[model samples]
Target: MTGKLVVGITGASGAIYAVRFLQHAAQYFDQLLVVMSQHARSVARAELGIEVGDGEQCAQNLLGRPYPNITFLN
Candidate 1:
């Protein structure tokens, strides 16, 4: 898939939505860049118990592996 995206996740307590979107879209998107804001981290920690201090790791866990198709920006 070829598209433009500016996905943003705030401190609303739902990282799964964004993570799931990336995993699902990775199947078709040629280039996927993820920009995870700082507030989202706390949300993940409070809601998901994933206090890793890195979006890449959380993303990998969500996708079940490392994918080169996505770029993670903390």
Candidate 2:
């Protein structure tokens, strides 16, 4: 409850679910380590109409904001 959490997301149909989970999880965890697959961006764009960018902008693009406690793993 007071530690880090690692979340892995693939090229699934329901990308919104992952996004929602991360949003809620961020409140409970100290840090969030997100690992997204190559095709995850495409799925997100198709399903949620969100552009999951690269590098430091990935989280921002996915969550639609900046979260200091979130980190993307490559």
Candidate 3:
């Protein structure tokens, strides 16, 4: 079977959930896409001490390395 997973990270108190979900999804999904809202970027900076820019590059920094079917949408 083939599948895709779409995860949206919002600006809230549960940012870790998104990260954990991404890690888990990376293992199972054929295509994993994570989209972070602008507010979520702010939240990430505040909570994770990571600065997210306005493009895919910032997401790349956060995600680290590259997975074949993983995509980060800023």
- Predicted structure with the largest TM-score when compared to the true one: 2
As a whole number from 0 to 100, the lDDT of residue 14 in candidate 2 is 90
Q: Per-residue alpha-carbon lDDT of model 3 for 10-50, expressed as tens digits?
A: 88877667766777778888997778888888888788877
lDDT of 1 by residue, 1-74 (tens): 78755556666767778767878888888878777677877777677667635556655654568877776766
TM-score of 1: 0.72
Residue pairs in clash, model 2: none
Task: List pairs with backbone clashes in candidate 3.
Answer: none
For candidate 3, the TM-score is: 0.77
Instruction: Write out the backbone clash pairs for model 1.
Output: 1-28
Q: How many backbone clashes does every candidate have?
A: 1, 0, 0
Count backbone clashes in candidate 2.
0
Point out where model 1 deviates above 4 Å.
55-58
lDDT of 3 at 72: 72
lDDT of each: 0.69, 0.88, 0.72
